[model samples]
Target: MSDALEKAEAAVREASTDTAAVQLAFAAMELAKAAQQQAQTVPQHHQCEHQHKPRRSAGEWLGIACAVCVGGVGIAFASLALAILGGTAAIVVLVLRSMWTDYQRKGR
Candidate 1:
């Protein structure tokens, strides 16, 4: 019974050693293959070619001009409204400046 036990223990140790050696061999082969592939690959360079587009149509330009005119009128009306509210634009500016200063002082 003791002899059988000793044989089983030796067999287990031999199998473990064989498995470790096989793993090391496979790892070495994989490393060599990777190195070979890295050495063989070459990088590529490319140049970009950009194309220019034509200008907008007259209708499109007119639309943009109209939009700008509308924005200007809106700004004018807003200024007028602010003036009528306090009888002067300076009052609105002073109020805005004071609010900003207070906000800054509060770290908000």
Candidate 2:
């Protein structure tokens, strides 16, 4: 940037017309100002691109496994209870229907 600015200064001094010299000087000043600003600016620290996650411990995994087992057992018990309840309901319905037919035959 300094080298470019020096070249621009030389060009402006060697320019024949005042108008051309003034334009070249203005351009050099803008370049120098930009370089100064860039130098004064602070550099930013780069962060890791990937996310950081803590790994699960063995105890946590064991706890999760135990919970899954308990859930499975609970579901099994619920299924068994539903089967029993359904069987009992079917039996009650069959008994009631049989009694109804018997009563109707007796009335006839």
Question: Taking the tens digit of each residue's C-alpha lDDT, what string does model 2 give over 1-108?
Answer: 999999999888776577787899999999999999987785655545788899999999999999999999999999999999999999999999999999999999
User: After superposition on all CA atoms, what RMSD does each candidate show versus the true structure?
Assistant: 20.7, 17.3
| lDDT values, one for every candidate | 0.91, 0.92
Name model 2 segments beyond 4 Å from true: 1-47
- lDDT tens digits, residues 32-57, model 1? 99999986774444434577688899
How much lDDT does candidate 2 score?
0.92
Which segments of candidate 1 are over 4 A away from where they belong?
A: 43-108
Backbone clashes in model 2, listed as residue pairs: none
Which candidate number would show the highest TM-score if scored against the true structure?
2
